[model samples]
Target: MRVLCATALALAAVVVPALTAQAEQPVNLGSTQIVDTVGALGGQEAEVESALNRLYNATGAQLFVVYVATFDGVAADESWATATAEQNGLGTDDVLLAVATEERIYDIFYPSDFQLDTEATREVENEFLPLLSDENWAGAALAAADGYREAIEGPGFPWGFVLGVLVVGAVVIGIVLVIGRRRASARHTAELADLTKLEQRASRALVHLDDSLTTSEQELGFAVAQFGTEASAPFVEALEAARTKVGEAFRIKQTLDDGVPETDEQARAGLLRILELCDQADDELDRQADAFDELRALEQAAPQTLVQVRADAERAAARLSAAIEALRLLEQRYSSAAVATVEDNTEQAEMLLTFVGRTASQAEGAIAAGKSGSAAIQLRTVQASVAQAGQLLDAIDSLGDRLAEATQSLDAVVADTRHDLAAAKAFQAEATSAELSAGIAAAEASLAVAESPSTLANPVARLERLTAANQELEGTFGRTRDAHTRIQNARVALDGTLATARGQIVAAGDFITTRRGGVGETARTRLAEANRRLDQAVSLAGDDPVAALAEAQQANSLAGAAISAAQSDLTSYQPVGPSRGMFTGPGVSEAVVGGIIGALIGGRGGGFGGGFGGGRSRSGCFGALGGFGGSSRSSGGSLGRSIGRSVGRSAGRSSRGRF
Candidate 1:
């Protein structure tokens, strides 16, 4: 029991110290030197602090090295480091390297704000921890600083050798694995669906990325040759970046193959990352290639673009000269509104020529400076200016032609007006119709207005007025001639109508007189009125044929009515049998009675003629004197001749100059 208790006490002593050690207080970091905390760094302080200061200056980060005889914590080295950093009020731009000398444990705590990648952190831990485990405190400190510097500076050496080493190692490893697995003839089917496809797609994408990088390098080389190395520097740098990205893609692919991740999801993720890198690299390569191609094309086209622009400018200048000269001539010789129009257009054209000259100069300078796109833009401007100058010249010529046409039209107007006036005067002299006299007067008045001095002051105004006058005179003369012919025809028609009315009146009077005892007072009165209307027609015929025609028509109607009435009365007065002889007769007594009634009605006809201060010629009464059918006999021939002479004389006196 004593031996067991002693043994137990010894074990307790050991266990209690360990447990207490595990619970020891974390160092008060602020109370110590921040650069070399715990004072355990000793003579290595300057070297370590210098390295850390350099890192801070380069990366805007602070570095701290913490040393302790021992630390108490179950957490990882980095977790204590983070707690120490936070308790000490270390900023986010700070880094802490915590070393526990007895435990051979070190932790690199990055700031919560400034994160370091796992690969670099693992590399640093891997490199420095070995020296710490060996108890080489100074050497471990130097290694930690070196590791941080190396991590910050990147691989510093060329990656090509590393890539070669990895490739050779992978090939050797793959061959060994294959040979050892060859004895197992059984093939394992793939468990996942997308892993094989993912690997293949990743491989293809890497190949495409390599191809794109190679092509971009070649194009960049061509651009350098064409545009000089100085101008192609940016493209070269971009091509180099693309090539580096391709190498990164290859490394990621190799990682997938050699690492052969434990899970299909991990394998798929690796392949996807590789593919994404390849795509990004490909985009950069394509962008750089396009830029190089564009630069080369511009370099090749610069001189020709300049030459074309200069030529266009010269042509524009020539066109402007021509346009200005034409405008000068128009201003000097033409008195047209178009002259002012041409002047304004020529000014615009001249300004365009000036612009062309300046743009052509700019194009020449751009060609000298090797900027073909700018030169091309200026050349287009020159071409547009030349087109505008040509348009302005065309406008000038068109306006001149219009002015010439106007002048010619003015002369034509004057000549046409004179010809129309002459025709109008001739028509007036020959026209005997009273209706045409007023029309002739109106035409002459229009011509006088056209010939007025005030109207002739402006040629255009004169032309307008003369054109109106010419149309009026021509129309008036045509109407005057037509009126003369129409009135003559009307006169002839009136003569015929009057003659027919006289015959009808005489027939009615003869019939009434032959039946005087049988005819009633109404028949007698209608016959009297018919003779009076026939007399009025004879008076009106020579002066107003239209009025004479109307009067003649009325007389004809009255005569027809009188004849019908007398026939009806005679028929009514006649007896049905032997007693009808008391009302009507065909004897000398009836003839004597008709003769007396005819004398009375003839006096009434003469009175109608006398009231109008006109005497009815014998020819006018020939129809009445010949009775119903008198003019058909041989004895009536001389009477007919005498009647024609008397009618002709009366017409000569009445129609001498009336029409």
Candidate 2:
């Protein structure tokens, strides 16, 4: 009686506590439709995914955990273990999930590097994050899961049937097929595994597309924010481009939404490709945005380049103003600079009229005081001012006659100035040449005294020594020895020449800057322009960036034209025809081949001396002498001069280019 009583008490003890706990805690009873992943361990076959779903139904066990695997028949199978979570209405490895149990919460993830247990029979229970506080299941969390599963079904999937089952689980998993979302009278969806596989593939693709769209939105917003105002035009274009792509993506997404519409693997692949295009468009839109920003920056820099040009123009204007001031001083001597500037320079010839009507006798006796210069000076000065005012002006050069007369009075002064300039230039040139020669002499002297090829300052001798070294090296060292020696010699020679040429060139530049004065300025301007053009040509000619020759040609044309115009000096000289290369005598055509063949006494290639005789010979000989055929006179070398002379002669009769 005592033993039986003790056993009874212990049993009662266990039973009472179990009842108490069961009363306080909630049970997460899941739909029997889903299987238990841990059923082999005596766990419940139906594991509650959401604590709220169980509590709402009021038939669940506490400590709800979603089954990584659901038992198809109250037990896990090898085939079911390997099956994707989506195939069983569970979450994919990549999906994020939230679930609540009686006492805890979980989050589930599938990183790329994740490894699944192949050997352990226990199904992987992915943890989902909780969205609840109560032990009893919240209805909201279950509602969320229902919508989430619908999202995987896509608009085109049999979502209505799937939702019906998730709603009450007694909308039997089998019944889900019997009354499809679109199967109005057809009774049920096809539940074949093959069809399910196709559905899963489409679901995965849609998921990827959704994710990419979210990324696109974020990236595009970021890019637009970065652009600022200067990017308005390009930003608009890029936005339009992206919008078009997004529309295309929507079409593809719609196709995907027609869930599992494909009948075969090929169709699946095609659908995947469509998704890929969407991804690609997304990437390209972002890339194009970057390019657009760069282009905008380039446009902004253009204004800066223009500003540089304006600054250069202002400098040129300043120089021109200075030259005009000097001209004002020169004109001040004759008449009121203001009046003479307004009068016809030759109207000062009216002053000459005063002289002419008076008499040579009166003119000869006129002025002795303050007349240090010739009378012609005063006459020319007056004439120049008058002519400039356009009263009696003919041509700018017309003033040359009066100018000569005036300058003749200053012959001694000009002579003295010219003498000084010539003397300075001579000394400058001599000193430059002397310094250069002295360096060369020293090098040569050193070269002459060297005995050994290796020790010599002469590069060729050094090279020779290197060659000997290479010859002696013979085995593996030969080529290396020769290369080293040659490099050393070449390096030495290059250094010497560069050092000696450096100072002479520098000194010559000094003289150019000092003596040439404004000419240096003009030359510097022209050279700089030329260099810029050359650089532009190189930039244009770039293989990927631009083309080389075309850039070079454009650069050359710009620089050449500028230099040619600068040479004509429109600010000083009257307009002249564009300068051509050295002018020379006119051309006579000659066929070199014809003349040579004629000398060989062979064929017409030698002209008249060749085997061909009579008319052919005469024609050949004449053609050879003309150096051309078809009466197309050769004119390249002497063309410029010939044209100049002809034009000048014609100008004597009519308006044309003279010099």
The lDDT, on a scale of 0 to 1, for candidate 1 is 0.59
Pairs in clash, predicted candidate 1: 432-659, 433-659, 575-580
lDDT tens readout by residue for model 1, 1-659: 34533443443332222211111111123422233323455566546645654564455444567776455654532366666655666554456677766665565666533545656667676787777667666666677666776677675676669989888999999998998686443332343545787888889888877777776777766666655676668777777777777788777777767855557667777788888888877777667667656555644676775576567657666676677777787676644543656668877877887887787788788777876655555565576787787688789878767766766786776667667667666766776545445555655565565456541133344456566666766676677777677777778788788888889988988776655544544456666766787888888877777667767776776677667656655554422233222323665443234334334333434311221123452324312222211221132111222232122211000000000
Query: Which segments of candidate 2 are over 4 A away from where they belong?
Result: 1-230, 256-261, 292-659
Residues 164-217, model 2: lDDT tens digits: 657778656568767665585433344345545655664575566556556656
Worst 10 residues of 2 by lDDT: 650-659
TM match of model 1 to true structure: 0.32
Please report the candidate that would top lDDT against the real structure.
Answer: 1
TM-score of every candidate relative to the true structure: 0.32, 0.15
